[model samples]
Target chain A: MMRRIQSKALLASFSLAAVAGSVIAAAIIYAPEIKPVERPLPTSFDPGEVAKGAQLASIGDCIVCHTADGGRPFAGARALPTPFGTLYSDNITPDEKTGIGNWSFAAFRRAMVNGVARDGSHLYPALPYEHFTHVDDADLRAIYAFLMTRQPVEQVQPKNDLLPGLGFRPLLAGWKLLFLHEGPSTRDPARSAEWNRGKYLVEGLGHCGGCHTPRNILGGEERSSDLSGGIAEGWIAPALDKSNPSADRWDEASLFDYLTTGIAGGHSAAGGPMGPVAEGLSTVNDADVQAIAVYIASRMKPESALQKAASTVATLPRDVASQDPASSKSTIAHPATDTLFAGACGGCHMPGAPMQVTGRPPLSAVSDLRMTNPRNAIQAVLQGVAPPSGRGPAMPGFADILTDQQIADLLGYARAHFTDASPWPDLTAEVSAIRKEDAR
Target chain B: MTVSLIVNGQRRTVSATPDTPLLYVLRDDLELNAAKYGCGLGQCGACTVHLDGKAVFSCLTPIGATQERQVTTLEGLGTQAQPGILQQAFIDEQAAQCGYCIAGMIMRAQSLLDRNPAPSDAEIRRHMQPNLCRCGTHHRIIRAIKRASAVLGSQNGKGDAS
Candidate 1:
């Protein structure tokens, strides 16, 4: 009986040990190890530092994504659409219950640098931590301080709707390992401070590459072809690199002007995605603009020198045609036509006068005459330009004012005088076609 | 609650619940339509206005806090006949498209120029960074500011009136 009792006791001990071992294994498998991180806080808090951080945060446009469309600022609820699924921005506000209120500085740093959350879960690149990694620790701390002061809301963002197979989470560990870098790398001290500053802003807060640089199928920026330009949300963020045709068209002054104002004469205007960037840069300091310009200028090749030289030469009629056109009969006939034009149209169409008539484009910069296609210009003249609402009244009908032949002559004169290009296809049929189309 | 304030050098009164934003008071009550309601939350600067000559996001400014304080909207800045330097510069540079956020941008730039007559590009970018324009006209906006700076600098140093 004693032997049987001892055997039973041994079996019972073995069973308990087995159960404990299984429990330990389950815990290891379910909850992986999260390494502890400690960061050194600054010796003394500086208000200026926090202010600078606020400015940088603004430059990065952190609030746009963190804040919901109609919700409280930084009560993060912005939904980002991705290939895998939709991911909502988490509440970064300092609400202990529902937000990152209790997170340590080290935890915040890790999130910005490594794309790892406080819980050690990998965050998707949609948050743009890849670019944030380039941010300095001091700036990061300042941003943290600014965020802490913001009123925290109790709103909890909805869970991301990721694809089923992609929800394993461990896969992100591998992705992060490949793409994400830790901090701003050591700079080559040889470069000018201006160039370095530009580099930092472009790669870090400006995140110019985020939109300007094309991405792969996985949404990772193609490192091989940086700043080559890319299509984002229907607008093309043109190539900012040296090879762009328009880059040479605009001088440094024009570039600086464009970045600050969103318009540059004789080239193009900022629109779509570039508009926000201009708005953001408009807030930035002039030194930074100079630095950015310096850096961009350094990248450009001298191949555009010829193009620049060519632009300086005058191509207007005076330079192109040496003789007084009045010496020729055809030219003399043009003055007679001009007399008629002056009598009929000089009162309002003269330069420096407001276009009183609605729907009539400013005759000064009307692209229709300059563009390769003259159809729009002819149509406007035949139909008489209708003014858009909120602008002013429409131009009266020119259909009753002049014959079709006179209208054509006026168009020819306008094109020849105003633009370098020749007359486009005859508009007699096009005008009729357009009127018919409008009727239909 | 009734809040009495000075707007564009004129005294005005507005009625709103204390919690209502200054943006609503300006747009809804005063009918000063330049300040737009973009993101509603201060993420977009489309609702920026000058409060006591400082640029602030009007959407977040509480109506109760604006009592007896000076407020200025874009209309207060200048008219087409006699535009402020910044407004004129904007026109010369053709710095608007849909023009939804221009008032805010102009106000922000006006504040920047008021403080510093000749702000470096970096300073301009830093100060104007908060305003978000989806139209991507940053290049021209920067140019207009620089142009305004030059124009203002050349003038006899009379700061932005509004």
Candidate 2:
């Protein structure tokens, strides 16, 4: 969020650069429209290739962004609110009218790898073509085959509402020139085949860095800080590298458990936007997920200062309000929220609780409570965690149950009791703000 | 391990493992049969009780965690002779078929009414989402909650039963 402020400040200079860049871009921004073809029957695709494509699609989490809330999968009206402005996802359901039903393989490839649409319009980077460009031709073809076979949904996604002057499509060619590296990714000679595959998926279709890496004002990922930390859907996707705030290191096993099942023993559960990602990966093949774990774990090295900061609180701090004689006059109920914790959260979060005995991470181990931003914690509380694998403890959201002040009190109590991190200032206001944001 | 709990405003010491769910302590050790164990996983609200005025799953809240909090079960709300407003509403409305989920439904509903004395029917349904009634007794249970809410709202001074 702090980085976002700095990026906003540079917008004036970037706008000047963009105007000059667009001039150069307009000269060479031509893409010959590939002729349309009749919608291919599902039977035309090889079953095995279709199945493989389905797996790849799940790994890519195609449905997460493409599908609008409570809308048909891949019908695509989901409004992706970026710092620049709101961009709507494209309908990729193969609908004859609105979707990619008429898209030929060449047209789809151009769009997938080069960010060009069937009508020769440049797509916003919201599609992550920079990463999609790394995917091999065969894999891209498989994905096309799978998408063409899906239930054809007739939906025309709303046009992107971008910042003024940013809507000029040719300007994106300049962005692509500077950012998009179109080609199959190279293998690291030192790494294993599985690790190489992991890198490909992570860099290509998985596009893990899209949410995990902070973006520049131009919306390109900050390559220097790949997967260090970033914001996703208003929640902090904590750093996955050496700067990871978890007291415990993310090994292959932990990463595998987390990526697949949502919850890992020593680490926090896959919360926020990652919830659906983990759930989607649950149905994927174990080998691919294992490979992903291998690469992700390899990235997570130990940093003592961060680990020390993340370590569980040695002792609970005394409540500062108890010293005040007027403390009993507060609106929040008496006997402290530890009792509220005992009631509302104790079942899954308290030490020695049932979920904890099953090797679930305690409140002390959960990174949300320990993170610098309170948004993740606030989001998790207001909108409870879904049991990732469908068997773990599924928490009911307290948004309807608890007030903002009550939620603030409970989290305040948790931070003081569980972690040594400095308490978040104005948690109640933060909760209210997050609630308002989610409402939008 | 011995755990001290403030149950029904009476300080009681019970010898049990620290991690044992408060549901077992209330039903087994303390012999308070009010909170029933329909689902140990907290999906069913049969084991819900008011822990310091907030309804929580007693089946999940460990006895260890309850040491610092005040625990109130169905028995604490009212005796058989003098039923609480919610309990009376349930009785008047005939909200139960098998009566297993009644206690939990009452506790969960009571927590909502406590927070919002005049919650809308939609709000009641949303608040009671976690609680389940297997006997298909939801219609009556909702009626009972509405009945109690109307009573509480109409009353000039709140009954200090809770």
DockQ of each: 0.02, 0.07
lDDT per residue (tens digit) for residues A1-440 in model 2:
98988888799789989999777666669777778899999999999998999999999999988999768999999999998889999899999799999999999999989999998988898898989999899999999999999999998988888889988988888888888888898899988999888989888989999988988877888888998888888788787787876524456777888899899775688877898999889989999999888777667754343345335333223332222322332224334565556556765665566777887777766778878888899999887777776576677666644678878987887776666678789999999999999878
Instruction: Candidate 1: list runs displaced more than 4 Å.
Output: A1-45, A183-190, A265-267, A300-440, B1-162
TM-score for each prediction?
Answer: 0.48, 0.69
On a 0 to 1 TM-score scale, where does candidate 1 land against the true structure? Answer: 0.48
Write model 2 residue lDDT over B1-162, tens digit each, in one string. Answer: 677879989999998765577899999989999899986767788998988888887876666556656888888878899999999999999999999988999999989988888777778887887888999989999898888888886683765222
TM-score of model number 2: 0.69
| Model 1 C-alpha lDDT per residue in residues A1-440, reported as the tens digit of each score | 99999999999999999999777644433433344433223333466766776777766777767877557888887886666777899888878777777777777877787777778777778777778899888878888776766677889998888888677665676566566666794565888887788778777766777777888877788867878776554344666776653444444555676676554433334544455566666776788776666655555435356356356522222321222334533335455444334333433444433332322333433434554445555555544443221122333334433445556666666656544565546755655554554343
Task: Kindly report which residue pairs in candidate 2 clash with one another.
Answer: none
Best by DockQ: 2
